[model samples]
Target: MIQDVLVLGSGSAGLIAAVSLKIKIPRLNVRIVRDPALGVIGVGEGTTPNFVGHLFDYLRISRRHFYELAEPTWKLGIRFEWGPRGRFDYTFSPQMDLQWGDLPRPNGYFCDDEFSNVDLPAALMREGKAFARQANGAPDIQPWHAFHMENEKLVSTLEKVAMEAGVEIVDGKVTGAERAEAGIAAVMLEDGRRLEADFFVDASGFRSELLGKALEEPFDSFGKTLFCDRAVVGGWERGEEPILPYTTAQTMDAGWCWQIEHERHINRGYVYCSELTSDDEAVEEFRRKNPKVPESPRVVKFRSGCYRRMWVDNVVAIGNSGGFVEPLEATALMVVCGHTRTMVDFLLQTELEPTPSMIALYNEQASKNWHEIRDFLGLHYQLNTVEQTPFWKRCREETDLSGIQDLLEFYRENGPTGFCRYRMPSNLSDFGVEGYLVMLVGNKAPHNKPHRVTPEEKAIWERHRTANIAKAKQGIDVKESLYYVRHPGWQWNDEIQAKRG
Candidate 1:
């Protein structure tokens, strides 16, 4: 019999692992332990597509219910505001199943505007429409919408689910562990109770207690590639207007600001460097700009990096403990979800092959995934238009290109990178090539030799553009759709205008 599996945290990753494993293998008893002092960063206010399908759908959850429970607002995608005042929204594509390109050609460009293909997704979003038509003309969507929720509420919700699934929750701090010839024999709790488990997961966030500190796993930092390690966060009430279905990322002098809507109010945060400004200075800066901000937001400092080894012996690390990129697109939950899912998949599919071999495989894949997400995030800074301060200059002139230099070079020569749809287990294009191209071209990332389409291709594109423009004009208004959802009983009746609330 497999001894109890101990999960060493209570954040999203820990909850996900506990719930997913219990659902997959009913026989194994799973328990989660967290230091009552160590609260889950109740600040991960955003989620990804997997939150809907993998967690909600498989777990038989109602979207409406989650909205009500967690006080969540739907996130369509991120609206990136950069440079002097450039702006564009990355709309969630509804018809993702329509493969853009075939195998040999393997690329389908999606740029139709001067600013990062913003026109296409923007047009679709404005029309309250989707990209392609399904059989019935209804939007056949992939699980794409992210969630903006109170982190505490989300954790509490998941904890309830874990309990319902027969997983036990233990509260306390872990003092240390007993290591044996083979692997970790048991975990020692602060209260002196020794808990034994065949397998362990550390979701302890930043404090890689089990894996990093105890097991001595190596960690690699990415502070050189990305900056803005500090952030200030606070919440506000949702005003009278219906909530917009997107998050706003606005570039500032020091770094950037994020605005996400939740059921109660809008959650706002500014991420920047502590080196340039102090906490008091940042607060003063924020006050000068928004004079309307009623209360002060809290300060949070973080490091951009990941573990060199995610799994060692019988232990695995997930979530913030493994690594984190700055929250440009809210990849925190998604990355954690990916790591948790990967761990579960690996454990279910394969037995514990020698510890070193298994760790090597996990490390290799984790590194690739980290770099893929890192490069994508770095693209924002690499192709920025902020020249206000040395911060912006560094973003533009930063030499640590990693894999983004090649992408920039390719887009500079070709038109754009094609749409990215690489799911886990298959690293096709983690960050769609087309999306990157649109941004580079939109931002005008200095290209020595830009690719020019042939006259024939240009003509074809012009014609298509003309037709698409007309269609876009005929699309439904997004704001109107949000209104309808807010008041679901509204209808245009036979006799007169009827409104039900």
Candidate 2:
């Protein structure tokens, strides 16, 4: 029987895993060991629609409280600046019934019937609106909303929740682990303290302290495909234009830049390949681009890849320690949260037999999920038409990759890159048809189709799209909606305090 678990790290993954386990089995002894020396990547703030039920409900984290502590502004969706030139907003759509089935196309292109109301968010934004608007009196659509939090806020919030739930939080670095023939027998901290547990979770970011050191699973690099390994991040106060309810991911010559909103200041970053651009150059270019609302940003470096095995023997790695893809799409948190949720489910529900077969299945599932996310992130680079610098050109022509060729070919014909679309079961259920359309059609990727459709179906789709757009527009006043949330009295800005109350 599993009596105790030692979670090694304090990032989202480590905290989430601990909370999930505590919520599942209250009596299980769960402890989080965090080292003050190791810094969190601290850049993953954007989230997907999955935050609603998967993360909030599972962690027993109050959604409203989370928003308040994180000083979170609602994220309708991401605005991608493709080719370093054009911008397109992929927002939450309202259209219904998008499924994976044989669809018909008129021009030998695989045409999915799931393209309705995909532009609703963009259209609303064009008219100055927030997608997930929470007003006092009016009935809200409650569309997909995720938080744009200071990563530190998220960690602190989760730490409080996990601690209150009876999980121990220890501040110390793990120096070594004594291993037996079975697996790790006990972990020794830098203070010369020994802690023994039945299971160990390696959430120690890229270091992979417990797993990497004990299991010795070599890390597999994605340097060949992903060029950007370093990032410089900083914050700026909301300017006179008012805080935008959406996150902007602007493509640059070497990499991409992200603009996220917090309560006091807007968090911004320029992610680029260190091999291509120096830190000083990136800083100068950022200053030149934005002359207003200025603050110096800090630089952080990283490798884009994961350990060959996320879990081996008695230990399982999560977050950056397990693997990391580019933050082009702000997928860092989504991947980590998704994996931790799955891991929790496995631990709570499935009995730990310690059999070779059981371990193999767990490893296989984790590896497949991680690789799928990596390939999907790689798609943003591989399918680009940008040739601005050696980075973009190399991305467009980068070979020696695996897994995504099928997805790319299918998209070239079917419309939409099907990269890592099947990782989570809830993705399809929550997103619906409009969601798929935004990714497939908005990105200018379609499939070769031969399914013939009658004029009746075509007319029906057009009519539905027009009607949905009209209704979404009428639901709320765009400018007024933004004003409503930005109001300080709304009490959504104090993320930490909200949770305590």
Candidate 3:
């Protein structure tokens, strides 16, 4: 049985793994090693509902405490400033995929001319609202909403949680790994100290020390599908900004830029291909677009790929050590939470003695998750209508859609029908059919079949949209919602908390 687990690196991924393992299985010993010299890549990060569930429900962390420390802003969805329509909202809640009781078909069919305000969340996104206002003037929070967090605050909160959960912290820089037949027997520290564990977790960011370097796991690159690699990251403090409730993904000459909103800051990063545009050129373009940034932004390089197997023998790789796609969908932390939860589940089910078959299954699931994300992100590039630039032209012409060809074909013929869900893979991503429909329909992708809505059905859809628009108009902004939640006399709804947990 695995009694002790040593995690290398103290980034968000490492700390999450340590805290999860220690909290879920109190009998096991979890220790995380870190080098004080290595600082985290502090930037703004956006998350999906999966992360919220993992933090508050699966791990049962106190929401109030997390809010106090992390100070995350709520994100209803993403506002994409791309494609033919100029922009569209992709909310966490289902809008296009939904079929109202009074409507004849799914909402996507009627969204040909006007796509906004299809649902409450999308409406809220359009109006720059975080949540709908209740009768008593409090924010009526829903499960579909997510968070936009500053990485430094999030890491510090996770470290605190890890320590409180009895996870030991060891300060050391790993120099080498002592290889064993099963996996790594021990890791050598720079100070000549050796650390041993029954199991190991590698969360060493892009370095991938344990799984990639030490174990020599083969990497499967997504170069064909994902081209943009370098990101110029910088931001500025907020002054009169309204603290918008969604991340903005705007199209650029070479690639795209993300605007992650924070309470007191607005973080921006331009992700572009180094080959297409030089670092200096990209920086110029970024500054031209966002002049509020006072200083030069630093360029961070990365590759898009995944290891052959996340779980090889006794060492399980999590986060960037396992794989990483771009932050187009803001899935880094979501992936971390998922990997940690799965590892904990496997250990618990097997009583800390996971069989070879169980490890194989885990690796299979991990690989599938990576591929699904790659395919979904590929769809974003494949269907984007911004075909003016050379880089975008290449993306539209050459992006690999082999994995999602069937889904695309169906949507092209059937126009975002819910039936496409039946044709999807058994292990579909968390995005589900709704995500694909939103991307396709939002981009106004061409379709052979078009639904001709009758007068009655059109009227019904109009009524629904109008109601959502009214409610969203009356909704609370992030600043207002924060005031209510942070008030000393205010209390979170017990029923909602119980449901989430």
Candidate 4:
């Protein structure tokens, strides 16, 4: 009977794990240990719709209260400045996957010449709108949109939520672990105190103290697929800039730069390969691009990979302790939510005694999740034709497309067909076929079989796009949406909250 669970570390991962367990299974004892000396890698973070669902739907956190605490801006999607065109928007909504009622082909087929205004969210992104306006002049908030938040505010909010959920918060630095036959028996703290639990969760970030150090779990690196290792991150206060509804991913000489927007700040990071560009060179390039930055940006180094198995013996690894790609898609929190949710589900399904098969299944799914993300990110580099720099030249020549070779082959032979979904893994990523098609078609990756549309079809597509553009223009900005939500008389719709289990 796994009654007590101890989570190591106090970042977003550890707090999320502790709170989730405590909330889902109130009978179980959940405690999280933190080293007060450690600080979070505070960079602006963007989230997918999955993170929103996990927080509001699964965790049952009050939306109104969350807004008051975690001051986040709305994100429609990402605006990529890569590929041949100036830019293209990839929204959370299903743009390329679904076909219009009158059209015979999927939306991707019509996006070859012009990629914008394919869906409402994409149009909203282009128009700098966060949400559609309702009849009463309120923001029509939907489930498909995401958020852009500062790391400190997000972590602080999670800590408060965890404390409220009956999770014990202990401040201690782990010195050593006592080895049991199957797993860790207890962890020794710096204060000369020992703590034990029936199960252990490693959320110790890249250190991976429990799973990687003590257990000596073998790591599978994604170096062949993801080459950019270091990121130079910095930000500036928002002065007169309009709060854009989408994150901007711009191409750089060595790698790429990401612009994550907050209500009052704009955070940027240049992710580059050290082999092609030195730290000084990268900083120079970053500063040349954005001169608004006041101070010298700090560099953060990381490897891209996951362990052989997330669950081993009685311990499971979550968040960066398990694996990490780059922040290209802002998948850090999304992955954390997924891992924690899966762990809680397994515990409940097995009635606290997880069988060997259950553990095996958990590890299998975890590996698939990491690999799918790796493959998806690989497509971005493999298909990008934006820059001809030494780094991009090497990427085009050597980037591994083995995992997504079949998908690419099918796409080249037949342009963005819905049938391509059959070629993907059974447990497809959140990106799904929509994401692949968006990247492929958006980048102008040539397909042999091009769909030549007739004049009538072209006119119909134009009409649809114009309608979307009109709606997007009528939508409200994040500032206006915030005003409505923060209003004293405003009420949140309970449709999503009502469906929570």
> Quick one: best lDDT, which candidate?
3
For model 3, residues 62-159, the per-residue Cα lDDT tens digits are 88889999999999999999898889999999987789998778889998998899899999998989999999999999999899999989989999
Q: How many backbone clashes does candidate 1 have?
A: 7
* Distance from true location, Cα of 67 in model 3, Å: 0.6
Q: What is the lDDT of candidate 2?
A: 0.66
Q: Which stretches of candidate 2 lie over 4 Å from their true place?
A: 37-39, 92-119, 132-143, 292-296, 352-354, 399-401, 414-440, 446-501
lDDT of 1 by residue, 221-243 (tens): 77777877888887667677446
True-vs-predicted CA distance for residue 474, candidate 3, Å: 1.0
lDDT of 4 at 248: 93
TM-scores for the candidates = 0.82, 0.82, 0.98, 0.98
What lDDT score belongs to each candidate, Candidate 1 first?
0.66, 0.66, 0.90, 0.89
Candidate 3 deviant stretches above 4 angstroms: 494-501
- Mark the regions of model 4 whose C-alpha exceeds 4 Å error after superposition: 495-501
lDDT string, candidate 4, 1-501, tens digits: 998899998888888899899999999999998887887767638998888898888988888778889998998889999999778999999888889899878888888789999888888888899988999899989988889999889889999999999999889998888889999988999999999998999999999999999999999999998999999998899999999988999989988999998999999999999989999999999999999875599999999999999999889998899999998988888899998899999999999999999999999999998998998888888788768999998889899878878888888899888888877764536888888888888899999888888889999999999999999999999999999989888777654446572
What local lDDT does model 4 show for residue 180?
A: 90
Judge candidate 4 against the unseen true structure and give its global Cα lDDT, from 0 to 1: 0.89
